[model samples]
Target: MPHYFDTAHRQEIETLRQRWTARTEWPTWLLLIGVYAGWFGLVLASDRLGLWWSTVLLIPLVVLWLSVQHELLHGHPTRWLRLNKMLGYAPFAVWYPYTLYRDSHLQHHRDEDLTIPGRDPESRYLTAERWRGSSLWVRGLHWLNKTVIGRFLLGAPLALAALANEERLKMTAGDRHAWRMWLTHGALTLLMLTFIARYSVLPVWHYLLLISVPALSIAMIRSYYEHRPRAAPEQRSVLNEAAWPWRWLFLNLNFHLVHHDLPGLAWYDLPHAYQARREQWLARSGGFLVQGYGQLWRRNGIKAIDSPRHPFH
Candidate 1:
């Protein structure tokens, strides 16, 4: 693989290193407060509004909350790790524990392992042996999952089931971290559900079906084509100069290569860093660029990007 940056660019990058302060980040705190207000406001108002209307308002907020949690996992908007974890402590997404997410995401920063199936926790590809051994129905589902349409529709539920099964195996094998994470997640989930049942107009089941499921679906649109298997690790991740709405919603995460390169960089500063060396970064990624998610939908809306099989396996 070719070099990603020259001497001049390296100096440019050096100047952008984050400056840590003793104070909290007010912008991030305000965002966190505003997001929670909107989410709960919608929940409380669900009784007066239409069911679909509530879902429409709540889904994006839920997705944004998860995005905020992703930033928190990176120890952003704050210098203290405990405080960051506290802010993201709630299990409103109702899927994974924050601790588990933090651990897995940090591990995913190993750029060399990006999109290597089992090696990368975030990878969506399947092993060749697993694909060949799958039943025809299972194979068909995998094919459908590769597309944007099927991904959001079926991806969340299937992924949740797979995660649960994986957690079960880990617990069975006496993984204490897995056990603690799941226990914490379960307790938080129960508390959240109880609150919803007692105070919110939306029932717990309805909240899960409406807010949680669709939030996962919205997230799938971003992750669907974020990475692909390649010999050169730099080329694995994509750079999507998507619209402002997406950039805001995903917190500038569309610049996957930038985040992978600078895992500790604050989310708000990604665009500046990317723009500073737009040409070089594009070259670094071997031109793995997408105009937007719309382009991805148009190209892979009907056909799959690659077969489910991980050729190496």
Candidate 2:
């Protein structure tokens, strides 16, 4: 790996960094078109060729849409928040509320904020206490959350339950936008369901699996080898160079350390920037997953789960 995550400011990168830039909405617009095109095309193709055949194309394309949405919401495809949200708000995901995602992901960027369990909505890591307190069923669920199959099968329901619990807590605290986000997302979710009910010949549940499940599965890959929470915060990061497929497919997200180093860095620049400081990132993460993502699977086992911390706060 040529790139690394650098904390000290660099003169070279400073010149390229944008404090603010004109928003570009085209990439998201193109992606939205692409997603629907994939859905309708797969629907037609499935009728002619059957789902197994369509899965070859369907799975990858759906993955692409989800990744693009991740970037768009992160201020990659645009500078303006509204424009950014407009492009990636595919109610089709049927899992994440885009507003909630934007809020949680932004929180994820705070330096003190990485993988704080309950505090960080996106963390999959478990705190030592949480790990110890688990019952047999929960332990099994945690194991499943770490794998592809578990993510596809149980990810959405588990995620929805978590998000709902969080939202109720927020509502009690009088979070101003709670109702609005719900109503807005509620509309989008309805549209997603309607699209399925009218067009997809498969059960509506099947459409959820085809799109929402895979979206979560891909998310698991991004976080899977990204962190391990050693006693030292600096050593907590991990890398996955064998993740070339997902990195490209996910707009360079597999370069997890770089994102952590300078999160404000836009998606387009993460690759070259990561390469530029690869050695430092490796040192920072205690030699990163430089060994490869295979280590994650071989040692961790397929069904693995961990939260960043317990008691979230």
Candidate 3:
């Protein structure tokens, strides 16, 4: 990471961004619309298709949809700003607002923006003070989130509530964009709930639990190895740990180095482009971490408190 902050390396990053981000406007728009519609349709169809296929198949589809949204948010698969946000912010995850994500993400790109617990919305890592002050039960719950059981069963709602609290803050403060985002998301949420309430055989809460838990599980995987401040500039992102099924599910975003290198590279192109620049990136990161989430956990895991200076603390 310290090695990566050097001037000679930054030119490489700037070059990659300039060359890859330029694209045909129309195709980008078409791809954006198509992806959003396809995923949203899959959500509705999951109900009709019954629990078996929905969980086994559609859940991954939802993850891919989320991955596509990630790309769009970075200005990909389209040139039009509003259209891209519409696609990414559709609330398919049913909890997070896209605008909020966009805001926090830009902050994340700041040079000194390592993990800051209270200030950084997307930060799962804790500040030093938070780590010290947390009760035994709360610490246990946070640990639970990293493991498979906690991630799938308990982590989803916990994460959602945190996200919704942000929405509530934005709403109370009258942030117009946040207001619009929630309005759109709220209407969709209501429609989804109402349909389940009136006609579905399963309890409405059950349907929500079934779909949302698995969907958020994918989010858990996407973020699993993505951040670490100790490593510094180059090794900032945690490399992907999941293989095969989970890898494709998150659209190869697991390749953390390639992502940081060419932030504008499309999903399909990331792996290839990364492979080309692998050596340079690896050297740059000071080989901070090359393993996946499992390896990370095996090492007693990492936390936001790992940093010398955590804003939350």
Candidate 4:
């Protein structure tokens, strides 16, 4: 990370950093606090409003909260690591811990290994040997997972299970750090659930099924095609330019290739930075671009966009 930027880009980034301040991040902190309070308030009133209606309304807020969690993990909105973790403590998303997420995501930013199947935790592609050894049913599921619809419906739950299983194995092998992370995450999750049970009109199971699942599914839309297998590693990340509502919900992550190129850049500044260097970014990514999520769904919602197995594998 010390050499994250070359000479020219380094100067531009240094100038940008000068303008960033703790005060600049107040809006983000305010939004996080407001959304969490609002979401919990809605749940508390679910009996009167109806559980289905409440869950439906909560989906977007949960997505926004998790997006902000991503920003916090990257050391935004505040310089203090302790304050950042405190901001990220709520387990509204439920399954993942901020500690584990921060570690894994930082590992994911190792540009040289960006989308390599076995190397990247966030990669959707299966390595060749694994694909070759899989039963037809397993292969079919992987193929379906490549499509927008399948990803929307199945990705989140499957990803949760996979991640949990990975952590289970690590803990079993005596990874004390992994053990501590999961233990702390479990305690916080139980604490959140106990509060929900105490006050929410909807049953805890109903809340988990109705709200958590759908929120995670919505996030899958952002992750579904963020990267692709490519001959050139740098070109693997995609630039998907979405308009207003979706862009705002994803916190301007549609300019994903730009984010990958400069992982330390603040979320709000992404759009401006991307616009200023639009042509350069497009060129750097070898033209891996899209208009929006709509384009992806239209093109690959049913059919697989790429094979489940990595092409090189």
User: Candidate 2's residue-wise lDDT over 219-256, tens digit each?
Assistant: 55556556555555556565667566666666677777
Give the alpha carbon lDDT tens digit for every residue of 38-144 in model 4.
Answer: 87788788778886788778888889888988888888888788899988888888878988888888888876776777788788888889988999998988888
Q: Is candidate 3 or candidate 4 better by lDDT?
A: 4
Please list the C-alpha lDDT of all candidates, in the order they appear. 0.83, 0.65, 0.62, 0.83
Q: List residue ranges in candidate 3 displaced over 4 A.
A: 1-48, 146-148, 173-177, 192-204, 241-244, 291-313
Task: Report the poorest 10 consecutive residues by lDDT, candidate 2.
Answer: 18-27
Note the residue pairs that clash in candidate 1. none
In angstroms, give how far residue 143 of model 1 lies from its true place: 0.9
> Count of backbone clashes for each model?
0, 18, 1, 0
Summed over model 2, clashes come to 18
- Which pairs of residues collide in candidate 3? 241-292
User: Per-residue lDDT tens digits of candidate 3, residues 270-311?
Assistant: 665556566765665666544555655555333322332343
Q: Kindly list the per-residue Cα lDDT of model 1 for residues 162-273, writing each as its tens digit.
A: 8889888999999998888788888889988898788767778888887898898899899898987888888999999999999999999999898888777667778888
How do all the candidates rank in terms of lDDT, highest first?
1, 4, 2, 3
Instruction: Assess every candidate by TM-score.
Output: 0.92, 0.78, 0.76, 0.93
> Which of 3 and 4 is the better model by TM-score?
4
